[model samples]
Target: MLSDTHPAGPGAAMRSDEDFVRAQTGIAPVPFVPEVRLHMAEDAIALWETTETARGERGLPPPFWAFAWAGGVGVARYVLDHPELVAGRSVLDLAAGSGLVGIAAALRGARSVRAAEIDAYAVAAIGVNAAANGVRVDAAVEDLLDGDGGPAEVVLAGDVFYERAMAARFLPFLLRARARGAVVIVGDPGRAYLPRERFAALAAYEVPVVADLEDAALKTTTVWELAGD
Candidate 1:
């Protein structure tokens, strides 16, 4: 498991809708649950920044992996925009961090959605977020491609290519699923390992990143659909 760094303190101030819209052009911190937001408010810890871990910081906090990027947002938008892809399909959201893509898939009318994550806190967050969205999703607490998992007609991965080691390992499992005839789709914001030609363009949208989340200075984010050939 990777290390986490959220600490307890005052709270991150809420942003106005105007500011949110403005910041939608850069990176942002998106919480998966009410409780998580409350905790972040209480601790005053920003969810997306790389900071020192606070003493006694509770469970695992949202990682960079949690938010939707241009890639994820695009794929999610495609899935939602085209309900025929999910209307009666079994879907698997691999590495479902904040569960945004998975929730989007469920909301788009998938017959069944299963969100799988390895982090304890993230798993808990997924359950809460799914409920909050009034969507039915099976939250699976396990690593990607572990066990004899059944095949899903569609698989979703968002912003998962950040780490070189992890990306190399993750590629084969995803390719294997594609070979099995699953409609594999990924959302990435040009992370280190994103191979441009692998995916066809779907859509582009600007997402928001919390002001306190990073030093990027720039706020809004760009999201894309990195799908297979």
Candidate 2:
């Protein structure tokens, strides 16, 4: 998930978002979804510091776009395995950090894919990562939580329930999308704020993740479909 801050920082004038992301990360295969590759950071703390230094700012959010979170990994794996869910459909990847899930949708033959992120750096990472995977994903820096989830037939959200405030807003947005006939899906690693009662579990997987980031080497992530009221 992303923070409310949107500034690219003062130093952003010197280096482009794509260039900063490339400089801080290395292209690598996702642990659980090896079929797709992404620009990943080697050290989370170091990269976070680097991003802050480059932006000439402190107290910025960590580089979430530089790692494949377990929730996102599980969602990407499910989409690739069950291509029927997104095949020939327009997909919206909400809070699409690293564009992992959206890229998977494209690889599985989604007619169109759009990855939405509030952070400009994440948007740039999405573009570069999609290109690395040989897929076309339109990445935009925008917050969609306030709107009826756009015009996509399939809506994918990963790791979005980790925060209380974000979860409050996101759950209603997802419910609105589902009510409007959009197929809404979410991938979560048992975050405290996830309203489990609002969704039905569709699939589960033991997703491998960076120990430094998740505290555990593996997370039991589940892919869920929003249930009707």
TM-score of each: 0.67, 0.93
Number of colliding residue pairs in model 2: 0
lDDT of 2 by residue, 131-159 (tens): 89999999887889988676999999989
* lDDT scores in order: 0.56, 0.90
Candidate 1 lDDT at 8 equals: 32
Give the runs in model 1 whose Cα sits over 4 Å from its true position: 1-71, 146-149, 211-229
lDDT of 1 by residue, 1-229 (tens): 2322322321211112112222322222333211111111211245423222321244544553334434445456566677787778899888876576787888878988998877544555565556656787787568766332256888888667778877876677777777677777776654678655666655454444344544342333233333554
